[model samples]
Target: MPGIVPRGRRGPEVAGTGEDDSVWAEGQVRTITDLARLAGVSAGTVSRALAGNTLVNARTRERIQQLARSHGFQLNQMASNLRRQKTGVVGVAIPLGHDRRQQISDGFFMTLLGHLADELTQRGYDLMLRRVLPERDEDWLSRFSGSGMVDGLIVIGQSDQFERIEAAAAEYLPMVVWGNHQEGQRHCVVGTDNRLGGRLAAERLIAAGATRLAFFGDAEPMEFAARFAGACDVAARAGVSILACPTSLSVEPMTREIAHHLHSNAGGFDGIFAATDTIAVACLKALRDAGRAVPGHVRLVGFDDLPIASQTSPPLTTIRQDIAAGARALVDLLMRRLGGENTESLVMPPRLIARGTA
Candidate 1:
C-alpha cells in the first residue's frame, strides 16, 4: 500500500502511484480522500497527521499536512463534531421585539452583532443567532439553552426579561450579557457605564446654559433607565426641571409624539437628552417639524454615536460606548466560563462625542 491509491470515479490513471490523473487534471484537491490519494496515504493517516498524532511517521505526516494546507482542504466539521459530541457553536440571543417595537436593526444591537460575529469567528466558534420575541414567548432562554444548540449563550439586551435571565443564570448556564449592571445579576455582563453617559449628556446641556431639559426615550429598559436616572440626578442639582417623553417603537409615531410634546410644551424645555441615537434622530426630525432650531432654540444630546448621528443636518453630540471592546469582553468572559474558569462582569466607560448639537 506504499503507492497504491484509489482512482477518482471520473477516470483511472496508472495504478500504484501517488498522483491521481483526475486530481491533476482537475487542478484541485477537494477532500481528504483526494489528499490521501495524492500523498499515497489513507484518510485515517491524514486525519492522524492533521490531529498532530505522533503515530504517523514525521516525514509523511509533515508532507501530508503541507499538501492539505496548500490545497486549502478543510476538515469536515460535522464529522468532527459528531465524534466529539460538541457543536462548537455559540448562541447569540437578542430580544428583537421585547419592547414590542424595538428591532434587530437598531444601531446598538446591529453594531453589537457585527462585533460579536467577528470576535466569535476569530475564536473558532460559530455564531447562532436567536432573536427572542418576548411578546410571543416567555421561556425563550430555557428552550435555547436546553436544546444543546450551543456551548454557551450571549444575550445582547436584557429587556423586560431580566428575571428569566436571572433564573437561567442561577441554573449555572454558561452565558454573558450585554447591558446595564443590575443589582443581582448572576451571569457575567459586559456593558457601558450608561449612567455616566447620561450624566455627561445632561452636564453638557447644562454647560451650554440650558435650564429646562427634557429626557427622551423609554424608562423601562434598565440601560435607558440608568441614563435617565443620571440625568435626573444632575438636573436636580442644577435646579433644572427635566421633562420625560417616552418614544414609540416606530419613527413616524415617535416623531409625532415628540412634535406634540414640544408643541404643547411651548418654550418649556431648552435642551433634550435622548437615550439612544435612533431616538435622538427622531427628536431632531420632530424639532425641525416644530420649527425649533437645534442648539439655538434647544440644545440636544444623544447616547450611542451611530453613523446617522454625524450625518444629521447639524450633527448630533452623543455619548460613545466602546462597542468593539464590549464585544470582546463579552466573548472573552464567555470563553473563560467555557474553559471552567469563573469570570467577572465588565463595565466600559462612556465618552461624549461633542458635535454641533451640544
Candidate 2:
C-alpha cells in the first residue's frame, strides 16, 4: 500500500479503515482518474501555467500548469540537446514524494539531486528534473522512448513504487534506480544497507539497556521495515520485546497519532526506533509532553540523522544513509551509460551517527 493514508475529510486520508479503505499497493499501477480534479481548469489557465505566464492568477492553477510545463520543458530540453550533437540532458524521474499533491520535497531525493547535478555538470551533462508521479509512469515510458528530451534516466522511488518502475525499465530506456530495486536483467540500483541501519538503531538502544523497543513512523517503509526487522531480529536475540508502529505524514507529526500509540503501549516500552528523522524528533517532543523521560522513560533512535537530530534536547542517535555516496554512485552509473560502458548496480553502507538519545 502507499503507506497508511491518515483519517481526514479533504487531505490524503484513509477515513475509517476496513477491508475497503486502503488504496495503497506495492507496485501498483496508477491512472489519470487518480489524479486531481483540479486539472479540470480551462485550457487557457493550463497554457499560462505551462508557460509560466503571469497571466494565470489562480495559485492552484499555476501550480498545476507549471508542474505539467516543467515536466514538458525538461523533456524538450533533453531533445534539444540531441539536435546539438551533444545532448547534456540527463533525465531523472523522482517519486511524487507525497500523494496526488505532487510533493517533490523528499530531502534525500533533493540532496541526491544536488550532488548528482553537480557531478553531471562537471561532465557536461545537464540535469533534467522530472516529477514522476505514480500516475505518470506509463507516460514516462512513452516520453523517454521517443521524446529525445533525455538520453538516460535515473529513477528514484520507494519500495512502494519500485516494482511498477521496474516494468518500464525492463521495456525501455537506459535507467537506474536510486535505491533498492527489484532484481531484473535491465535495472541497476544504488543504495545503502537499510537493514544495517535498522540493526544499528536497535543495537544502539540495546546498549543503552532498553529492553522494550518499538520502531515507529515510516516503520512500514520497505527500507524502514528492513531497519525494523533487523532491529527485531537483534531484539529477539537479546530477548527484547519490540513493536513496530507506523505513522503517516498526513496526520499531525507528534500529536495524538503518537500519543495514542504511546498512551496505549507505554507500559513496558523504554526505547523507540523511528523510521524517519522527522517522526523521531516529533516523538521525542511527544514523549516529553506525556511526562515520559528520554533515556529514563524511553531511549530514542532515528534514521536519516537529519539536521534536527542534533538539535533535540538530548540529541539523537541514529543511522545515517550516505546520501552523498548514493548520489555519487548514481552519477557513476549514469556516466557509464553515457560512456557506453556496462551498467552495474552499487550498494553503499549506512553509517551510524551516535549522539545522546540512546
Candidate 3:
C-alpha cells in the first residue's frame, strides 16, 4: 500500500489500519499504548512525551507528537489525571448558612467570584463553583473535601457554620475561607477587617453630626456581626445610641424591610449604617420615599463599597473592602496550603471612601 511504512524487524505496517488489519499488521494507533508500539518506545516514555515533560528529550517528544498527530491518537486527560492523583481543579464553595436564599449572583459575591476565576485561571487551574446551605447539609464541607473532583477548596463566607468550618479545617489543610478571623481560629482565612470597617462607617456618620444610629442588615453572620460590633464600639465611646434593624439580603424582602423600618422608626434614628452597600442603596430609596433628605434629615453609610455605591444619588459614603485583593489572597493562601504549608489568615484593612451620603 502507498501508506505502508517499514518498521524494520516488526515488518511493514499500513497507516490508519483498524481492528480488521490482517494478521500481518499491528492494528491501528488510537491510544498512548498503540502510539508507543508504532514509535518503538515504552508507554511511559510516550506518556511523558505527549505531556511535554522535559524528562523526555525534545527530539523524542517531537517525534512522539508527530506520530500521535499522524495516527490521530489522543491522550485521555481524565485517565491521566487519575494516574497522577490530581484533578487540576479548585472548588469554590459559598456556604449560605445564615441566609440560604442568598444567590451566587449577589453583587458582592459575583464581584469576588469574577476576581477568583481570574486568579485561578492565571495559575493554570480550573474553578468548580458550589453554593451550599450548611444548615440543610451538615457534612457539606466533608463531602466536598473528600470528593476527588477538586484538588483544593476556597470557601466564601463563614456564615453561621463557624464551628463546622473549624472542624473541617482541623482535618483539611488545602482549604481557605473568606470571613472574619478570630484570635485562635484554625482555618486559613482571607477577608476584610469588618469590625474596623464598621468603626469607620459609624465614626463618619457621627462626624457628619448624627447622634442616633441604626445598623441595617442581618447581624447573625460572623462578618456582619463583626461590623455591627465595631459600630457599636464607636457608638458607645461617643455616647450615641445605636440600634440593629435586622434586614435580609434577599432583594424583595430587603426592599420591603427597609421601607418598613423607615415607616416604623421614622424619627428614631438620624444616622443609618448599612452592613452592605446593597442594603444602603435600598435604604436611601426608602428614605426618599419617606420624604427624608440625606444629610439634611438622615446620614447613611454602607460597607463593601461596591460599584453601585458611586452610582447612587449623592454617592454613598461607605467603607471600602478591597474585594479584589481579598480574592487574590484567598487563591494565594489556598495554593500555599496545597503545597503542605501552614499559612496564617490574612486580614486586609478597610478604607473609608467619603463620597456624599454621610
Candidate 4:
C-alpha cells in the first residue's frame, strides 16, 4: 500500500499523513466539502473564496486558498458550473464584413480586442472570441450566448444587423454592442459619439477657413453613418458644401475610390474628413499621387487617431476615441447584466486631436 494514506485526520507526527501528503488519495481532500472541513470553514465560504468573491473576509479567503493549494486541491469547473449555473466565461463576437469572409484585420479591431482581453482577464472572466458570418449564421447570437458556454456576450460590429441584435435583446440575451446608438434600439451599447466626432472634424476644418470640403468612408457601417451625418450637419449649418465620397473597408479598393473621387472633383475640395484613420491614410496616398499638398492644398481630419495617425508625414489631425474606457464600459455593462442589474448604454465623448494634417 505504498500509495495509500490514512483515511481520516492524523496527528502532526503521523508518517506520510501530514502536509507532505499532497497527492490525491481515495479519502483525501478532493471536494470543496472536504477542503472546507480541513480549513475549518463552510463549503459555501470555500466556494466564494475560490471564486474570488469579495464577500469572504480577506484573511479567511487567503487561509482557505493556501490550505487548498498545500493539499493540491482544485475545484472541478464542470461541477462548479452546474452548481452556479454559470460558465464563468464571456463570449466576444465580431461580425464579418459584407463579403462574409473578411477577417477582422483592421487596426481598430486589433487594438480593441487587445484591450478587451486585458480587461476581461483582470475581471476573473475568460474570453472566448466567436467570429461569425451573419450571412451563414442566422442564429449566431443564440449559438454563442445561449449555448451554456458563456455567461454573457460582447458584439463588436452592428452594421446592418441592428434588427437581429434588437431581436436578441428583446429575447433577454445578456449582451452589449460596440456601435452607435439609434432610435428604438434596446440593446446595451458602448461606443463613441460618432456624430459629434464627425461634426467636430467638419467644424474644425471650416474654422481653419476651408470652404469646399469632402467626407470620406463608406456609410454601410452604422457607426460611420453617424459620423457622416454629423459632418454633413456641420457643413450644412456653415453654408459649406460637403462631397460624400464612399469607400469600402478594404484599403486598395478604398484608395481607388478616393482617387477617383479626388480626380473627378479636382479643384473642388480644399478640406476632407475621413471616417477612420485607415481611410485618411488612403486619402493621403491618393493626394500624394495627384500631387496635392496636405494642409496647404487639403486640410484633412480623420477619426480613431490610430497609431499610424501620428506616424504619417505631417501627422493626421483626427478624432480620438477612448478605446480603453470603451472596453471597460462594455465589460462592466455586460457584467452588470450578468449580475442581474439593469444597465444603460454608455457613450464616450470624442476628442479632436489637432495635428499637422489640419
**Best candidate, lDDT-wise?**
3
Inter-residue clash pairs, candidate 3: none
Rank all candidate structures by their TM-score, best first, as comma-separated numbers: 3, 1, 4, 2
| Model 2, span 42-152: residue lDDT tens | 655554555567776678656775555443322333333564655667888766633333224545556778888888788787888877665646465447545776778
TM-score for candidate 4: 0.81
For every candidate in turn, the CA RMSD to the true structure comes to 5.9, 17.6, 6.0, 6.4
* lDDT (Cα) of model 4: 0.86
Candidate achieving the largest TM-score = 3
Candidate 1 lDDT, 77-180, residue by residue in tens: 77787778678999999875445555586788889899999999999999999887876887788888877678899998888878788888877647999999
Q: Which stretches of candidate 2 lie over 4 Å from their true place?
A: 1-86, 97-103, 136-138, 171-173, 181-186, 250-254
Whole-model lDDT for model 1 versus the true structure? 0.85
Per-residue alpha-carbon lDDT of model 4 for 36-143, expressed as tens digits? 878878999999998789999999999988988898887888888887799879999998857243337778888899999999999999999988888888988888
Model 1 misplaced regions, further than 4 Å: 1-44, 62-74, 100-102
Give the local distance difference test score of model 3: 0.90
- Give, for candidate 1, the lowest lDDT window spanning 10 residues: 16-25
